[model samples]
Target: MAFRRDPKTPAMTTDLPQHVFRLRVRYDECDPMGLVHHSNYLRYFEIGRTEFLRSSGGRYREVEEAGLYVVVVHIDCRYRASARYDDEIDIVTRIAKITAAKIIHEYEIRRGDEVLVQATVTLAVIDKTGRLQRVPEALLT
Candidate 1:
């Protein structure tokens, strides 16, 4: 997703095709110390992936209804900074790699270019019966 920057703000472009999923840190996702709970980063990664797919002309539900689902097989998150309640964060995500049955996505969570978290996730396409399946070509397009 693109942020609506002030007209005076210069834009930065990159070769990496990515989606920016932005959200505010909610009270329920924060700890007593006002820092976001560590686990919530995983959720942000997922949101990043989902939005990336959607914005790129794919939909998670469409694939699921066709008997395919992307299941997280592995995840690694590195916290670089802490986020507290009401902090607006942008999760930048891209498809790092794709294979017949699996795909990898990379993510970086930022509060206006200051990365607060970075993560990588591996996902596999599987059917309801747990049989491996190929990712739809539409998703790769």
Candidate 2:
């Protein structure tokens, strides 16, 4: 489901496409102490971004077939709380910024209203030859 907007959060203004993706934490996602492994948060953010792209009619296969790919340029995840196995989590994703050749996505991993992780990922639109290219116009709308 998609969130209408969060009036209180400056980040949730009406301009960008905000997508919410939900998932259940699997047993393998946790560590010996039972908290989700730090690296898995990156994976969750990826899932959130991919789903967001899908809703915008941006199919990865179609993009690749057109000889374009979204390749990660930067990622930063900040841990705030712990996530445990079997927990139902939500990954809130939004387009933080879009330029001629790149897109930036912001993500929040939460268990209910409690945020477990916050992340920002930057990706470049690259061609099959690995050279930067302009982001597709369809993705911005």
Model 1, global lDDT: 0.82
Per-residue accuracy of model 2 over 1-141 as CA lDDT, tens digit each: 332335554222235568999999999999999899999998898899889889877777887888888899999888999999999999999887666777788999999999989989998999878899987755555
Measured by TM-score, the strongest candidate is 2
What candidate 2 gets wrong by more than 4 Å, as runs, is: 1-14
Give each model a TM-score.
0.86, 0.87
Per residue, candidate 1 scores C-alpha lDDT tens digits across 1-141 of 222323443322224578888899999999999999999999888888888888877899888889888899998888999988999999899766666677788899899979998888989999999999887766666
Span of ten consecutive residues with least summed lDDT in model 2:
5-14
**Cα lDDT listed for each candidate:** 0.82, 0.83
Poorest stretch of ten by lDDT in candidate 1: 5-14
Q: Residue 54 in model 1: shift from native, Å?
A: 1.2
- RMSD (Cα, Å) of model 1: 9.0
Q: Which candidate is the best by lDDT?
A: 2
